[model samples]
Every structure is written in C-alpha cells, then in structure tokens.
Target: MVKSADGVIVSGVKDVDDFFEHERTFLLEYHNRVKDASAKSDRMTRSHKSAADDYNRIGSSLYALGTQDSTDICKFFLKVSELFDKTRKIEARVSADEDLKLSDLLKYYLRESQAAKVRLGCEELMMGILVCILKQCRAVWLGSQRLVDWGRRNEDLLYRRSRSLVDYENANKALDKARAKNKDVLQAETSQQLCCQKFEKISESAKQELIDFKTRRVAAFRKNLVELAELELKHAKTGFLCVAPAILELTQ
Candidate 1:
C-alpha cells in the first residue's frame, strides 16, 4: 500500500494496472462479445466489412477513453458509425452492470449493458450516449474535486493541532493538571476517530455512486433500445430479402 503524506492509503497495483483492472476486464469482455456478435452477423453474410470497421473504431475509442487520450477517443467516436457500434451492446447491458458488484467503474459500465431491455443493435447507440455521459461526468468530477479539497483541509487541521502538557511543582497540583490534560488527550483521540469514520463514510459513498451510476445508466439504455432493436431488425430483414438473390447467383 502507498500512503500519502497525510496518511491516506492508496493501494498498490500491478504493472499493467492502468488503475483500470476492473474496467479492463469489462471492456475486454464486451469487446469479445461484440466481436462474437459481429462474427455471427458475418455468418449471416451481412456486410461484415462495415461491421468489422465499426468494431475497430469502437476499440480505438475505448483505448482513448481508458488512456484519457483525446486523439484515440476522436478516432473511435469521431465517426457516427463507430460511436453507434461501440455503444449499442453497452447500453443494452447497463442495467445488469449496475446491479452487479464491481471493482472498477469500467466493469460497472460493462455490466450495466447486460440489463438492457432490448437485445438489439448496440453499435448505433454508443456515441450519442457516451458523449452526453462524458460531459455530465466532467461536471460531477469538478464537484467531487471540491469535496476532496474539503476533506484534505480537514486533515490539514490535524497536522497543526498542538498538545499542551503542563507540570506543577506541587504533587497535588500536578495530579489535578494531569487529569485535565488527560481530558484534552481524550478529546483529540475522539476527533481522530471521528475523522477516520468520516473518511470511511466518504469512501463508501463513492462506492455507492458507482453502483448508482450503473443503475441510472439502465434508464438511458432503455431509451436507446428501440433504435438498436430497429437496427437489428432491419439487418435481419435486409439479409432475409437479399438471401434469394445471392443463392440464385451462387447456383450459376
């Protein structure tokens, strides 16, 4: 564990630890699922090329978001197609993720996608939703920073607090003063305990926020499901209608 100057314990992580181990798992899993879905579409002899391209774009955006690299984010999300492909399955699963226990925010987001009411074209919904979510998160992050600052200030107060130990030449006087000093010491100890408890509560609150985020994400996903379903349905109908032409051409 790494302790900050003020004794805040920051846990140790592994080398590949992008501080997103939990998130990475979810991303990789989702990526795999999307790839699987695309592969299935390929089996249907749909426009695999377009889907594959969208898949790459989604990966690129995921990489950028994970690294906080706008360039990568731009590559993935700049195109409407890429955005939709990436976001589609995710929103579909958002409700599930919210209800699950997660060690990382990314994982939480990933799990939420599972609870999606409509299992449909996740690709189309990825961009618009994320663009909005990111903007909202920026505002919330700013607010959190202020709260963190307040916590730090409260800790700072502890560092400057002084203890006074007075000694009287007379034994009786010394005993009396010691009793009073002991009370002061007890007060300090109580304050420290209170701070510890407050810190713990704050940590728990952060955890709850993550859970709540996953939950709220489901609502957004519900709104997006219709479009996803339409896309999937369109793809299915298009493929069905096109099969006869391809079969006839192949028979030649």
Candidate 2:
C-alpha cells in the first residue's frame, strides 16, 4: 500500500492523470450544483419578499374597510388588520434574515467558484474572499494537462526511435539520421521528465487543498444554516406572540 500526498493510504495510482481529471470533473459538477442552488435560493428570497408585500397589502385593504364604517364587524376588521400588519412586518424580517444568512451564503459561494478574476459586487466582497475548491481545481487541471503533454512527448519519442532504428538497419547512410533522432529523443526525455516532476508537485498540493476546501465549506454552511434557523425561529415566535392576544379577543 502506498500513501497518497493527501495522506490517504491507498494502492498505487495506475494513472495519475485519470486521478486528477476525475477530481477536477467532480469539482466542476459540484460547482454547477452550487450555482443551481444559488439560483433557487434567489427565487426563494423573491418569493418571501412577495409574500411579505402581499400581507402588507391585505392589511392595508382591511384597515381601509374598517375605517370606512363603524360597526362590530368593522372593529373585528380592524383587529384582524392589526394581526395582518404584524404578520407583514414579521414576514419582512424573516425574508431579510433569510436573504442575509442563506441566500447570500449560496451566492457568495457561487461567485467564489468562479475564476476570481472577475470583480465581485460590493455585497459579495463584504461576504468574503473568493478562493476555494475552484482555485484548487484549476491547479489540478493544469497538472493533468502537464501529464498529457508528457505522455504525448513520450509517444513521439517512441515513434521516432522506432523509425530511426528501422532506417539504420536498412541503410548505412541513415546512421547520421538515427543519431540525430537519438539526440532529439534524449532532449524529449528530459522535457518529459520535467513535466512529470511538476505534475507530481501540483497533484500533491491539490490533494491537500481539496481536503481543506471541503472542511472549510462544510463548516461555513453549517454555521450559516444554524444562524438562519435560529433567526427564523425567533421571528416565528415574535409573530405568534404579537398575534395571540388579537386571536383570543376575536375568539371571545
């Protein structure tokens, strides 16, 4: 058993390029999922805001009806309107909290998964820096490309070496050509070796970076979700508390 650079004990890698390519693909897919989630969250935020506005409009209509006339029914309308008003405010508060804690969190990550060359909005900048899985995936991709180059060079060297060997065997005049091919093969070998070394170094760092990326992402999501849940609960309780007395009076 051989230990990988990420400190995971495993069997030897038969194909280093395949390993990193798989990782890069997974990260890209994961980023796409995050983008989808961010879009959904934005929709949810808009829905929440719309609901709050609807509550406010309903409350205003009820209030207008109550004030247009004087009767027990009108008083009841006023009381109901108060309940609706409280609901509107509470809903607005909940919407804001969700936007701040949940929707923004997803948006921030979505932006972070991008190349980071593009400038973010002032709001996203305030959220945090944009360096994580995507950045490391880029590194992994470069490393995989280097491995591909090395493989291509090695294949070229093999083909040339075979051709030169055949030519030298067929004609003594081809000796110089074979020597020239050998020199090219030696240079290609050196370049391929360098590529392999750089790829190995990148792969090692990428493995560790990916591990850290996962850890940080999980923690951040957990923290944001926990806070959002707490805020929602608080708003729910406050809304209930504000409407309870009006409900009791209406029932009586």
Candidate 3:
C-alpha cells in the first residue's frame, strides 16, 4: 500500500484492481453517452441545413411575390390612366367643352377612388403575409443556430471523456505490467530457497522496494483518476452555465 497526497493509503493490488474496474464501468457508460450525443449532434446539423433551405426557399418566394405585386400595381396604374382618358373623351363628345358635367366628374372620381382602395387593400394584405413569413423564418433560423452551438459543446465534452478513458486504459496497462514483474520476482525468490537464509536481508530489501514501487504507481493512478473527475466536472459546469444560457437566449 502507498499513501496518496491526501494522506489516504492506496492499496497496490486489490484497491487498484477495484478502482480500475470502476473506471472501466464508467468509461463504458461515458462512451455510450458520447455516442448518443454524437447522434444528437448529427440530427441538429441536419435540422440546421433544413432550416437554411427553408429560409432560402421562403426568401425566393417573397422576392417573386414582391415583383409580381409591383408588376400588378404598374398594370393597375396604366388601366386607371386609360379609364381617365376614356372619361375625358366621353365628356368631350357629350359637351364639347361646357364645364365637364358634375355627374361625369363624380363618376370619374368614384371609379378612381375605388380602384385605389382595392390596390391598397391588396398590397396591405400581401405585406401582412410577407411579415408573418419573415417572422417565422427568423424564429427557425434562431432555433437552428442554437442547436448547432449546443451540439458543438456536447462534442467538446465527448472528446474530453474519450481522452480520460484513454488515460485510464494506459494506467491500467502499467499496473498490469508491474503486477507481472512482482509475480516473477516472487516465483524466483521462492525457487532459490537453498541460499534463502544467506540472502534473507537482501530479499527483504527487494520486497520493500517492490512494495514501494507498487504503492507509488497506485497513488499516481488514483491521482490521475481524481484529476480526470475534476476535468469532467468542469466540462459539465461549462455546458450548463455557458451553453445552456446561449440556447435560452436563442429561444428568446
């Protein structure tokens, strides 16, 4: 056993083995979580693309509608001019120049006023529709952007988790190698019992060195695990505090 920086005794074999097993379990769970997060990220990316496509389509439609409205307005204005010219011709034929009849003037004014009102109403209705569509497009754009940001944050977390797993695996392999060496030393010492008494002191010193080395290894591995845990916690906090708020802002 070896003492850790925190003054806690760390076992060389049993405790280390148990710790590694726990880490393996955690790594498995973490890997699954990463996979899930990746799938979600992919979905979010696809959604963003779809939203962008929709925005483009809607923008094109709005442009076409605006152009059509302008063309229709121009046509209506020309038709109104034609009506006025016809009215003048009729007035000339009816009275040659006697101050245009009050009835004729009233008729012309009423027709012009009605046509203007209809054109204004149509334009207003179209504008309202365009405004509604634009608002919807803005909301969709915001949602897609939020998803992309969230997904990127998740991917960063996943990368950290993966690195931690790799560290754990490397630590486990080192421990395994140390254990094998210790086993070889034990077997050789046992087989050389003919001179055991003469070499008793040396054997004891060797045993102590082996124990110290194993203890140090265990303590170092435990420290690594602790650091990994802290890093994971930091990532979790960042996601909640930073990414979550950004997502909320987008929603708003």
Candidate 4:
C-alpha cells in the first residue's frame, strides 16, 4: 500500500529518514500526540462526547492518581493508547475481511478496549473489563490459531492480519530485549501486566441499581420505535389518538 509511482512511498516525517521503516513515522506521530493528549487532564474532556470518550478521559484521570511518579503515568497512558489504537485497527480489518463475521471482530475489540480501560480505570470498570477480556482473550487466541490454519488451507486469502498482530510483535520484541538483559526476568502476563489489582466480581446491589435505571430507559426507547410504527399505521386513521402526557414525555 505504500508504493509511489517511482516505487517509493513519501516519508511524512521531516527530521530523520528510514527507507525500510514505512510505519515508523506514522506510529511515532500517533504515539506523540496520544502521549501528550493523555497526560493533561485539562484536555481529557471538558465535555464527555460518548461512552468510549468518557472511558478514555477516566482512564487518563486514573493514570494520574494511581501512580506516584510522572514517568509511570506517562508510560501507562502510552501503553493504553497503543492497545486502544490497535483494537480500533483490528476491528476495521476484521470487518473488511470477507471470511470473518463483523460481530466477532466488534465483540473482540469491545472486550479488548474495555480491558485496556480496566487496566487503566477504577474498581467497577476494572472488574467489568477484566472479566470480559479474560473471556475474549481465550477466544481470540484460539481463533487466531485456527485462522492461520484456515489461511494455509484456503490459499491464504481469508482474513487480513489484525492490528494487534503488530502490537503483539512489538511486545514480543520488548520481552526478548528484556530477557537478553536479565535472564531471570519473567515476561509478564500479556493481559494483566499493567493491571495493578485483581478486580473481584461486582456486588448484586450495584448490578441491580444499574439494571433498574436501564430498564426505565427502555420505556423511553420503546416510545421512539412505537411513534414511528404509529405514524405508519395511523396514516389512514383520521381521529385524534389520545396518548397520555406521561407517555408523551417518553416520546421526547
């Protein structure tokens, strides 16, 4: 994908140049921006945009609090950004692959994303992220092995390489380097190396409270769907349909 008319991809970075390193410039720029953005709580989010955005902000805030040193916070945030970016790219690649169901990819990314946040969030968020990630990791590990086998069986055209594949490669290289320095150093668990604490399963009370609020929100959810259905059905009905004002509130 990085070939120009002269069979050369133009380098985006100006400072230094490496011909063989196609992804180096883009990766460096991405890392630098995320590193800077993640460090400042001021720029985290003045206004929460979406659920993912909210988690990202909270993750950054937690990074600031959980560590004693500035270097620790910066490193943790960079690790999470790497995970998040890789997860996004993997989701896109899996979606575009004709051999894979997009649902599986989305589910994998969702769990990975949440897991990254958990390694970086609070008690409740961490527990949720851990549980989901544990399950997803097992499935993904198996799936990737099978995918490789399938690729060999099918002439290697089924699925594109996942973005996490690159992250995994980088992580393995780091592990190898560390191992070379000190043979006694055990490589940490791939999933929980950065996870500070083991999150216990959440309490029933918290689950119930969240569920009750969501159940109430569904009353509003149905109103929008029902309104559209009614509009279609009542095109022939001339009389005024009397709907209660309390129900009208749900429409909005």
List the RMSD of every prediction in angstroms: 18.5, 14.1, 32.3, 27.0
lDDT tens digits by residue: candidate 2, 56-80: 9999999999998899889988999
Model 1 agreement with the true structure over 43-116: per-residue lDDT tens digits: 43333444545556665666556455457444433443334444443333332222221112222233333312
Q: Which consecutive 10 residues in model 1 have the weakest lDDT in total?
A: 160-169
- Sorted by lDDT (best first), the order is 2, 1, 3, 4
Best model per lDDT = 2
Give the Cα-based TM-score of candidate 2 against the true structure: 0.62
**Per-residue alpha-carbon lDDT of candidate 3 for residues 24-72, written as tens digits (9 for 90 to 100):** 3543554455445445544543554454455445545544444565576
Per-model CA lDDT versus the true structure: 0.37, 0.58, 0.37, 0.34
Model 3 ranges with Cα > 4 A deviation: 1-16, 69-187, 190-252
**lDDT against true structure, model 4:** 0.34
Name the regions of candidate 1 deviating beyond 4 angstroms.
1-8, 12-47, 50-184, 220-226, 243-252
Off by over 4 Å in 4: 1-169, 181-192, 195-222, 239-252
TM-score of each predicted structure versus truth: 0.31, 0.62, 0.26, 0.18
How big is the positional error of residue 93 in model 2, measured in Å on the Cα after superposition? 1.4
Clash counts for all predictions: 18, 0, 0, 0
Measured by TM-score, how close is model 3 to the native structure?
0.26
Model 4 residue 136 lDDT? 36
